[model samples]
Target chain A: MRRLINRHPSRRMKILLGALPFILAVAIYAIAADARGADGPDKLMPGLNAITSAMSRLMFDIDRATGARLFWADTWASLARLGVGLGISAVIGLGLGVPVGFIPCLRALFEPFFAALSLIPPLAVLPILFILFGLGELSKTVLIVFGIAPFILRDVMLRVAEIPREQIVKAQTLGASSWQMILGLVLPQVFARLISSVRLSLGAAWLFVIAAEAITAEAGLGYRIFLVRRYLAMDVILPYVLWITLLAFAMDYALRQAHDAIPWTRFKEGG
Target chain B: MMAVIRLDNVSKSYGETVVLENVSLTIEDNEFLAVVGPSGAGKTTLLRMLLSQEAPSSGRILIDDAPIAAEPMPDRGVVFQRYSVLPHRTVIRNVMTGPEWLAAPFTGRVMGRARAALKSRARNMLDRVGLGDHATLYPAQLSGGQQQRLAIAQALMMNPKVLLLDEPFGALDPATRRAMHRLVLGLWAEHKMTVVMITHDLSEAFHLGTRVVAVEKRRHDPHAPHRYGSVITTDFDAKPRLARQIARAPA
Candidate 1:
């Protein structure tokens, strides 16, 4: 941040430049919302008051149907589903990727299949997942895992493959078994790439989960957005969109920090 | 008399593209054997075969009068022209990897007495290679010469019976190369391990090798230069300092 500020004209200028676009966006949104509201009180653009009221209502008001804070319920449900889905993806990606990249036998076995799999649009298989796994949490999680696992796997494989052959030879001469070579040499080196891949695929993971939830679900952020769409509740939708963005941003930032902290990865300083 | 390592009519090819053809060599224990040849003359291929990283298409490589195994063993240490050290590991850790990995097949952890013994051993090797002060630093932190030195130390840590060097000093500056030459000679004298070095530098081969072999393509037709692959063309004894040392020893 210090370097960033110094490279700009001044710290104050940097801060102003950073905030200007966002402030401009907010002002434009407010004006548009107000103008539409003025022309039609039932306009689709919900003014600040409408968003504030919706947020408060969503935060505090207990649903008569379930006696739960619907916003929190939706957030929790989506979070839990995504957590499990992405967890499975990381495991499959890291587990299969390193071996396939390092060993020619495994590469021949799995690489072509994954290469073909990655090409197939994940959304095209959504209906199949629902049919196979059935329309439950299982199907939703499966959709997300299917959506991002291939991407993560490919990223990890490429990273592992990029490790110089000389290093592999050196490891072999050091008396490392194939397993030990993978564990000690490849695993730690590919970790930062795995983190980067996970972050990259997070967007697609969210897309699949939200699409799955929108089609069918009892309680989720996506379900809530799609549910309120019938009522044209832009006030609820906008804040929810912002909340999701904020969550995704936080996750990306956290992954980036972890990537920076690793000294051996190509992302690290002097690397 | 049993030869420590032997190559019997070894031939290697990638489909039609032959690299090495019908090469026979015998390596006695404690001999410093150097191979010199032009690029594409199969010097690297020969070293790769001995490391068991590549297989000869025909004939065989034998160690201790038995056919060599498919996998590379810690009994043989190799230093490549480049990327011999894993950049992620610190110098000490890089040297210690052999012992730690060997221990893992049994203990799964190099701990208690084993870890201490390995550390001391690694430190000793590091000191021998003049990297005692930089043990905790990563390979990236070291200069190219220093990194190569560290690699040499790492290779020596397993007490390998055969030390194979593939132009290990090729990347160093001239002065550094000379220093490395002296260092390698000292290490060879102290350890008495059988060494096989593949080099393009004729001087390095002569300076270190007890025996030097030239791998050259025997052109069947002058018009068709690429028709034949590399075979042992010249096999001769080098300046034998080891012989002098043996003669001077009080028997």
Candidate 2:
């Protein structure tokens, strides 16, 4: 299996594989267009036409709108919410999870609570959140943080716990302190796993943010989606969904690249 | 020279299982001592007790005439049989971690001075291990011998007076193991550090250890049984020859 991946395909083969999906999509679109003549695109999907049109119109708006456009504004707002949420989660997760993971007693005491909390979806507690914080970015951001923190925390904790006891013993013999064991020895190895966990939890947090914003947001991409949905503007809804997905994709890609490009790649092989 | 470590009438057990019994040994400063035995012969258990990573159920362990109460001292360093090198750090970073941990916190001057000193010290040690060129490489990128060198470098980072090695080359192939043996000896001779190593390979113990101690099952009297018989330390010239000689010895 490794040999297969290592065997580099030629440029021509690469191009063919890269173009296959687009070629298929275009072929399908063309055939549908030809099948339905006058209102071919619409006729291709009678019920879904409004969705397609609404999406196209929203795309048009996003492209044409100039200063302080809602699209860009919502994008930035959603990104800000995600950033705050992910950052809070990262800090809190690592800070608490590492110690819990290192100490077995703490793990026994706290892991169950975290596990129980994680099982309850953050979205399910939206009413309580709305009652407390109302329809604001605070509620939505908090929702994202809650959604991701437990999952990320649990993963980081497990990774930390899995650090070989031998390594800890070695560090102890070397006269490393508790913090040194964590930062110099434990954290370095756990960082990669933690980063991966963050990435995984980021996707969950994004999903939760959208759900949260849909219910309690005055602004954000989810709010935009909600506003468009009120009038059955499928065009706007589709584009909003696309934007959210694109944002998630971009963030995830950026994270992976940053992780890969780190100079510490010299020390560690895999997360 | 005074004995850096002393274990007197030391006995250890896990629940009902007795691991080591009535074990007494003195490791002098600058001595390279190797404890060798068959698998589960309590050689590792003795090393663990000496390292202060584990406590004997009964008896006392002293380091520099002081009781080893908690973890081993800053003056003591250890290399494990595997993964002694932190995989996520650079080679130099792994070596420097010891000093950096010991340095003052939250001050630029302290950190800066420590960093410079660590860099120079780590480089010198890495060069000694013949790994100067691979300072930036991860342990995974290095060969078994090279990773062992990195592990050795990490142990030496603090200029420890005592270095504990637990089967350092146990996992290496014969050729790499032989090369590592030479490397360790050279390091020991240069550093003149006290080394207490555990090995299953009798030959390795004889070659590297100034005084090789053998741990093996002994006949128990059942009436007043001791878990371990007397550990016999031989001045084996070479580890491999020691293995052959032990094999020839009567049971």
Candidate 3:
């Protein structure tokens, strides 16, 4: 038989090759689930049917306690927290980053402080945040802000610093005031960079949100995962994990698409 | 001819290292002045002082007999060796930056008659520089020569009283360099703008410049070679001297 491995696949064949791994993974999972089910039907590794049914119940059925669909509620709650936290971080990032990058005095004042702050793991401060802000939405949101803001700020500062020496000279010679230089030249370029940095930090943002929610939350993807962990219902847990991964992937894809849609983002996209 | 700029007893040093020493010259209005020197001889240092990018350690630089300001302003346009045209903008917008910079905020959007006028002027400058069809292209899309042409167009849009070019065409191919030489000379003549240029090419210096000045370091004790900095070693009318050099050359 002619080996497909040694030869390049045609476009039609490439699609099948791409799907082959996913199909194999599902097949392996099914086989494992079956082997476990043969011995102990009430098992940790859930079969395909059990997972699908559990996913449907979690998504469609109204919870008896809240009279609300559980999955959608948790998803929206987590998304809301992440969105608000990252949004505030975007503002703080640009705010702190631009001045620190441009002004000598501000750079001297704040750079060392924040450079050290970024070194401390954000989760290490989670308990302190909870203690200070109490176990509420603020603490959860604050945790994410604390988690992602420093990284975003540092990235923005570096972006501003990368503005070439000649460009600055050229701008100044064009009769731009210092304020105009910063606002006009720096602001326009840095926002696209801000988005790219935020995308990278979104993984950490999700981690912080889930950690906060798992520790204390009324409803969230993280909260649900933690709540279901005690029973070892791999059915619900596996689907939830997959759903979060799917959501994160969708968000990352959306940001990349948004970045490409903008014309001047080539520089920001590169670094 | 009236003196458009004057540098008196200028010297620049950074800590123990000296760059320029005791340089003085009077630049007449609408005159093309080319400065040439070996590497690290402070040819660019002189232009920087004129552009207000740096201050002389001692002595004053006067423009049109008025002392130059501390900050660089659009009144003195410049094209550096590197293409100074913005990367993200189309050619027209890059050329339009000066007027837009003076008037527009950082929004990068312009509208109404002001925008139309700036665009019209930019288009005309681009056409003059042989980039008429390239207005929609960004800097990276253009060739090295084309990018230099765009940089020139951008600098000229402000219609500066003085144009300072720091080896602007050094990166272009010889053929492109010749074309840029023609373009620059054409603009210089048409605008009657004061031109202060730094160049390493001797033929270029003589071809375009009415006056040529060479900066070189004075001989020092071998042990104290760093003691003396570069000075304006030769400053003369280039027209007569260039005629002599060209006439005497073997064909």
Candidate 4:
């Protein structure tokens, strides 16, 4: 028999090990809800059945006033804001970051300023953004852009700068002009890194979008969560939080798949 | 023989540190010149000066009896010890990059019949370097020897007047290095280009060069090492022995 430290689990055992904690947490929640008594007024931990029934109603029923499903409406609104904000950030990051990193004059001029911008706490400026853009879609989208754009830009700049000097010289010897170098040599490497930078920034992007919606929004995931807080609607809130987690995980997984599709990204430099 | 490149009292210094001093030499067209020196003797700095990547602090360099350009141009091709090939491009594309840039300045690519011509030329160059089968692979996917071959192919594709190599095969095993020596000698004879190769290996210098030049510092300061810089100390003709040896060696 192998010692415990040296022992490794089989594939089936590994899957079971990964699932152990989630099952334990659900079991604990069910037992606690039973102990509190199903008929009790304490709504802090609603039973699983109540949460499921609430989710089904949100999914299947239409509101009489609006004649639209609330769940889908909120999800679509939040996704749109996130998408528009990230798209703008990606454009700005690629446009400014490539030149700034490749050209020394531009790097000297803008690198310090961009660094300071990234250091600024984006949440602290939320009130200013709201005042300037008004409490509308523009403000929410700007908030997400403000939160992650600088970070993405900074990552792109550093990556471009990190390209080996030898490669740059080789390209120059091959008769590449400044424009040609940016497009042929620098842009391809920076584009791959930008995908990774965006993937890493997703968590912060979600945070900013949710905060903007919770403060003031007609329809969004965060708005709905905040709206039901007065009634202690844990049954709806719990399921919504889980749904948001699932959505974020799916997006992250999809980006990873896209990144893997580019074959050269997986190539590691060998000496 | 017409002189292809000439260095006139060239000296380079960085602030308090002097790297090369008063180096003067002339290279003939179609001559293979191998430079050998100790570490920190500024052999690479000399190559950079020839490549026009660095301007001499004091002197001027001439090519075809005219001053060398301020920046690197396609007339001179170079391969460094490492990072010589673009990792993002496949093997054949790396070789095609030179002509593609020359033909299409903005896009760095060609289309239609031009593209096909460039691809065929690149393929031919790859075949000469023995990398024809690995043309679809990335540089990172290749072994050290294969990567060096790819770098050589990429450089040769431009049909440069002067080919500069700085320890191109320094990272390869001995067997691969010997193979590369034969490949480079064959290429040099075929292309009729003046070649300047810097190496630490003395035997390699004697084996491949028509003429061998050695650079070293004449004087050293005990307290301040940077007070003096390296200069060309030895230059000799090796073509007689090299010719005799090559005639006997198998291709």
Highest-DockQ candidate: 4
After the best TM-score superposition of candidate 3, give how far the Cα of residue A229 lies from its true spot, in angstroms.
0.8
State the lDDT at B61 in candidate 2. Answer: 84
Docking quality level of the chain pair in candidate 3: acceptable
Clashing pairs in 2: A54-A235, A55-A235, A266-B138, A267-B87, B203-B239, B203-B240, B207-B238, B207-B239
Candidate 2 deviant stretches above 4 angstroms: A1-11, A33-68, A103-109, A230-232, A266-271, B105-114, B219-251
Models ranked on DockQ: 4, 1, 3, 2
| DockQ for candidate 1, C-alpha atoms | 0.45
lDDT of 2 by residue, B52-160 (tens): 7788899998878888766666667788888777776778777776666667432211356667877898898888888899888877788877877888888887777
Give lDDT tens digits, candidate 2, residues A202-266: 77888887787776655678878887677665456655776788888887898887677655653
Candidate 4 reaches a DockQ of 0.78
Choose 2 or 4, whichever is better by lDDT: 4
Per-candidate local distance difference test: 0.87, 0.75, 0.86, 0.90
Model 4, residue B10: displacement in angstroms? Answer: 1.0
lDDT of 3 by residue, B45-91 (tens): 88899988999999999987789888788888888988477776778
What is the lDDT, from 0 to 100, of the residue B76 in candidate 1? 84
lDDT of 1 at A194: 93
DockQ of 2: 0.41
Better of 1 and 3 by lDDT: 1
Cα misplacement distance, residue A149 of candidate 1 (Å): 1.8
